[model samples]
Target: MDLHMNGGIGEASYASNSGLQRMGIMKTKGVIEQAVSDLCRNNVNFPKTLVMADLGCSSGPNTLLVGSMVINAVTNTSLEMGLKSPEVQINLNDLPTNDFNTIFIALQELQGNTTNGKMRDVHHQPSCYFTELDEVNKGNIYLSSTSPESVSRAYLEQFQKDFLGFLRCRSEELMAGGRMVLTLAGRTTDDPRVEESNRLWGPFALALQDMVFEGLVEEEKFDSFNLPQFTPSPTEIMNLVKMEGSFTIDHLEIFDVNWEAWKIMKNDNDASKMKEADDGVGHGVAKAIRAGIESLVANHFGEAILDDVFMRYGKCITDKRSNKENQSLVSITVSLTRKCDI
Candidate 1:
C-alpha cells in the first residue's frame, strides 16, 4: 500500500485513524527523551542550528507530537547545561502523497509566528524511498506460522536492502556524532509468523479467507494479496546497523502492549468491567487495523467490500479476545549515533 497516498482527512485516512500509532509513539517517549538528552550531553560540537528529520512521519497529531517532544528534550537539556538553545530545523518526511497540507496547517496553528525563529524551515522531499522493491509480492506473502520459508526469506532480503539504504542516506546527512531515535512495530522473536507478530494480521487474513468462501471476493484476488509491512527482530536490526557500518546502536529496547490496552485505558481503566470490555477491545483493535490496511485491501478487493471485510475481521478479533487467545503487539525503539569520520 502507498501509505502516503492513502492517508489524509477521509474516513479511512491515517490522520483520522492512527490512535494506535500514537500510543506506540507515546510508549517510546522515554527512549526519545533519553536519546535527545544523550545527544546534547555527548556532542561537544553540537550544532548551533539543529537539523532533525522524522522519517515515515505520517500526518496527523503524532507527526507534530514527535517534533515537539524532541524540541522540548533538547530545550530542557540545553537549559540544564547552561547552553544556548539552538535554532531548530524540523523536517517532517513521509511519502510524496502524504497530507502535508494538514501538517503545515497544524504547524501554523501551533506556531503562530514562523518568523519568531522557533522553527527555521520546513522542507518537503517529494521522493524519498531509500530502497525499492517489486510490487509482485502484493497479495502472496502473508507470514503466518504455516507460511513457507521462501516467503520469509524474500521479506528479509527486501528489509535488509531497505534498511541499509536508509542508513546510508541518513549517515551522509547527519554530522558526526549526531543522534537518531527510531520506533517501529517489531517482533520479539526471530520467527516472523509467531502469534505476537501476526496477532492482528492473522485474524484479518482469516476474515478475507471467509470472504473468499462466501464469494464476496474472488479467491484469485485473495491469493495474490500480501501486506507491505515487515516487523523486524532486534537482532535483525542490530545486524543491519553493523553491516551498514555507518552508525552505532547506542540503545535498543522491545516493549509489549496489549492490543486493547489503549482502549481499556481510555474507558477509565475499569478492571471490574473486564468481561464487558473484552469485546470493545477486539473491535477497537480491528478498527485500528482497518484504518492502516483498508487502502491496500480496497485497491485489491474492490472498495465495495471494505465495510463487510472489516466487520468480519472485527468479529474474528472479538472471538479471539473473548476466548483470551490474543497476544500483545510488540514495539522496538532504537537509538543510534553517526560514526565519527576517521
Candidate 2:
C-alpha cells in the first residue's frame, strides 16, 4: 500500500494535527477498554504474557495513548481478579514512512510513569483510496451525486479485492481469541454518492480545481489520480466479515458526531478559548486535513503547491461553513474476535 500519513513533529505533520483522530480514539475508548476487560476476565486461555498490536498506528501522542489504554485495561482487570498484572507487550505497526522518532521519544519519556495511565512497558517500535470518483468529487473530494453508476461499481469492486486481502492478512496474524477493535470512517447509506453521505473532502477539491484552472497543476495528472478509499456501509462490513470467515463480530455500533462535537467533548468550556479557536476554524480544519493527506497529495501533485493549496482549502472551509451547511463524521466501530481454528 502506498499509504502513509505525513511524517515529522512539525506543524503540518500528522503528529501535530492529529487531534481529530485522537478524538476518535477518545470517543471509542470506553468500548475498547470494555473489550479488553472482557478478554482478560472471561477468556479461560488468557496468557500471562499479553501482546497488543495497534495496526496503522501513525505517529503522534495518540499512538501512545492507545497503547496506554490497552495496558491500563489489562492491568486493571488483573488487579480486580486479585492476580498479578500480566507482562504486557505492545506492537505498533505503521508504514515505514510514519514518524517513529516521535513514538520512540514518547516511549522513553513514559518509562516508570504510572501516574498518567499511559503505557509503561517499553516494547520495540516497528515501522509500518480514493479512486477516480473525481468528477463527482468536484464539489469536494469523495463520491457526489453526479458520480456515474460505472464509477461506483468500480469502487465497490476495488474495495472487495483489497479489503478481502486485508482481512485475510490480519486473520493470519491474530492468535485465536485475539480481539480487534476497528473504528473507521463509514457511511450510513448504501449509496455513498448521495450528497448527504460525502465525507469532509470539500475544500481540498476546490483548491485543486483552482490550481488546475491557473495552470499550476497538470490537468492530466490530476485526472489520473484517485484516492483508493471506500466508505463501507454496515451491511457491506458484515458481508465482508462473513465472507472472510476468520473473525466473528462481538459488537458493532454506528456513530454520527457533528463536525464540532469532538471539540466540545474535550470539556474545554472556556468561552474565550473556544472563540479564539473558532476564529481560525478554517485554518485549523485545513491543517488537520493536510496532516493526514498531504503525503498522498504531495506524492501525486508534488509538494510545491501544498501551502497555497491548503491555504485555499481553509478558505473553502470557511465559505462552506458560512452557508450554514454542516456535516457529521460517521464512524463504524466494531469489536471482532479471532475465531478458533476448526
Candidate 3:
C-alpha cells in the first residue's frame, strides 16, 4: 500500500541521530578498507592517496561516521604493512531533496576532529566535497548509497541503471587500480526460506482483515494491500556486474542484521511473531499499511480505528515472541570494486 509519511528520514521523528547511532551501522571502516585493498592489489602505479565519494548521503552523519571508520582502517592496515599512511579525499553525494541543513551541521561538527596522521608534517587532512550526480565527474575514489525505497518497477529499474552509470563515471575518474566501494540492501540468490518472506505481515493483515469484516475499512480500499519485493540477492548483483562488465566482484558477502530486537518482545507465537518479522522485513509494507490505515481512518473510519488497529498490531508484535523457527529481518550488505582490464 502507498504510504503518506509527511516527513521522511530527515524528519526529526523518523530517523533521529540516537536511533541511527544505536543501530551499530555507523562503522563502515572495514568495508571501505577491503574495497581499497582490492583495488590497489597487483597495480603498477598505485596511488599514494585516495579519493572517496558516498552517493545518497542523506546527511553528513552517515558519511562522516563511515569516513572516520575508513580512515582508521587505512591507518591501521598501513601501519601493519609498515608503510606510510595514505592521503585521503572524501565526498558526500546526495540528491537535492536531502536535508543539507542537518548535513552541513554534522559536517561542521566533524571537521575539527579530523586527523591526517598519514601525511608527513603536511596536514594530510581529507578534503570533503558535496555535490549531486549531475555535477559529479570521473575519478572519484568511492561511492555509496543505502536508500530503501523500491516501490514501482520503473523506479527500481531506474535505480539499477543509475547505479551502473555512476560506477562507470567513477571508474573513469579513478586513477589506474583505484577502487569504488558500494553498500546496498540486497535479496538472497534463492532466499533459503521463501515461505517466511511474507510471513511477517500475516498478523497485521489478519488484523486489517478483521477490521474489514467489521466494516471498518472498505473492500475496494483493501486493494491497496499490495507488496513488492525489491531486494536483489547477492547473486543477482553479481549478475548485474557481469552484465555491465564494468566493475569486478572483488569482495562480495552478505550478512543479516537482527532488527527483531523489539519484535520478539511483542509477539509470542508464529502467527503473532510474523508481525514482528513484518516490522523489520516488510518495513516498506508496514509503512504502506500504516499509511493506508491512517488515511482511511482519517477520511472514512473516524479516529476510532486508528488507536484500535495500531494498539492491536503493537500489542501483538511487542508482547509475543517468535515461534523460534521463523525467520525475521535479515539485512544484507554487498561490497564491490571497479575492475580494470588487463
Candidate 4:
C-alpha cells in the first residue's frame, strides 16, 4: 500500500490538484530564505559549489519553486557580500512512481537562461520512504483518540525508525555546516490522537463507513485499511534529531493554515460568487487528499469506488465548513545544519 501521487496533468494528478501543498510550501519560504542566508553567512569555509536537496518533491508547478528561490537567495546574498554566486547542484527526490519526466520538463521551461552563469545542475532521485515499515499500516486509518495503546506504539515505533534513517542518510550527504530546510504536515500537540492530527481523516473514515453501510465497500476492508502517514509534533521531531546527534536544529516553526486558503478565483470582490465557484476550497482540499492517497485506496478497495469515495469526502468537508467546524491543517518547518564535529 505504498502511496504516491496520481501522476501527470489529469484532474486528480498532483500537478493539477496540489494547491494546498503549494500554499504550505510558499508559507515556509521565509524560513527557507533565512536558512540559506545563514548557511552563506556563517559558514566561512563554504565551497564554491553548493548542493541542495528537496526531499519528497512531487512534480508540478511547485516542484521547481523552491529551487528557484534558493538560487535567487544565493545570488542576492552573494551580491550583498561582494562575492560570486556558487554553482548550485539541486536534487529532487521522491518515490519511483513520481513523474520525474514532468518535473524535468517543468525545470527546463522554468530555468531557461535564468541561472545567471551559476551552473545550475539538477538531479533527480527516485526513492520511496527513507525506511521500510509494515505494509498493513501503509494505507490504513491512523490512530484516533479512541485507538488502543498498542496501535499508537506501533505507529510511533515505525516513525522513529524511518525518521532516524532519514537523518542518518542526510547526515552522510551534507557537508559540515551545510543547512537543510524541511517542511511537512505536522501536529502541534504531542498527542498523536488530537483532532488537529486526525481531523481530515476522521471525516474521510466516516465517508468510508457510509460506503460500508451501503455495501459499496467491505466493512472488513474499511476496518483494516490505514494511512501510512504520520504527522509529528515539534517535540517529537526535536527528540529524534537529538537522538540522531548528527544535525542541529537551527529553527523550528509551526503554521496553522485554513483548508479554504488554496482557492483560486478571479472574482476577488465577490464572496458569494466565489462560494458558488466550481472549484471551491472544500472540493480542492478533498481533491488534493485524493490525489495523494487514491492509488493506495484503489489498490485495497478496488478502483471502482474511488470516484464515489472522494465525492463523498468532498461533501463531508463542505458539510464541516458549513457547520463552522475548525478545519485547519498544521505544518511544521525545521531548519537544520550538519554538526561540524559529527
Point to the candidate with the largest TM-score: 4
Per-candidate Cα lDDT values, in order, are 0.73, 0.71, 0.47, 0.78
Tens-digit lDDT track for model 4 on 168-222?
9999999888898888789988889887788789778878988988999887798
Determine which window of 10 residues in candidate 3 has minimal summed lDDT.
135-144
| Candidate 4 TM-score, true structure as reference | 0.91
Worst 10 residues of 4 by lDDT: 265-274
Q: How many clashing pairs does model 2 include? A: 11
Q: Sorted by TM-score, highest first, which candidate order results?
A: 4, 1, 2, 3
Worst 10 residues of 1 by lDDT: 266-275
* Model 3 collision count: 18
- Report the C-alpha lDDT of model 3 over 1-342, residue by residue, as the tens digit: 222221234322222222222132433346676766654444565457767766645443343556665666666666666777677766766544344555555555444444553322211222222222222211111111211222233334544675567566766766545666666545454542243333344455555566778988665544433333345556656766777776666666555434342222211212234232344433333333353235433444456676676556544444333555443444455565565572
Q: What's the CA error at residue 110 for candidate 3, in Å?
A: 3.1
| Each prediction's RMSD to truth | 4.2, 3.6, 11.3, 3.6
Model 3 — TM-score against the truth?
0.59
Tens digit of lDDT per residue, candidate 1, span 240-259? 99999989888999887666
What candidate 4 gets wrong by more than 4 Å, as runs, is 112-119, 130-140, 264-276, 323-325
TM per model?
0.87, 0.87, 0.59, 0.91
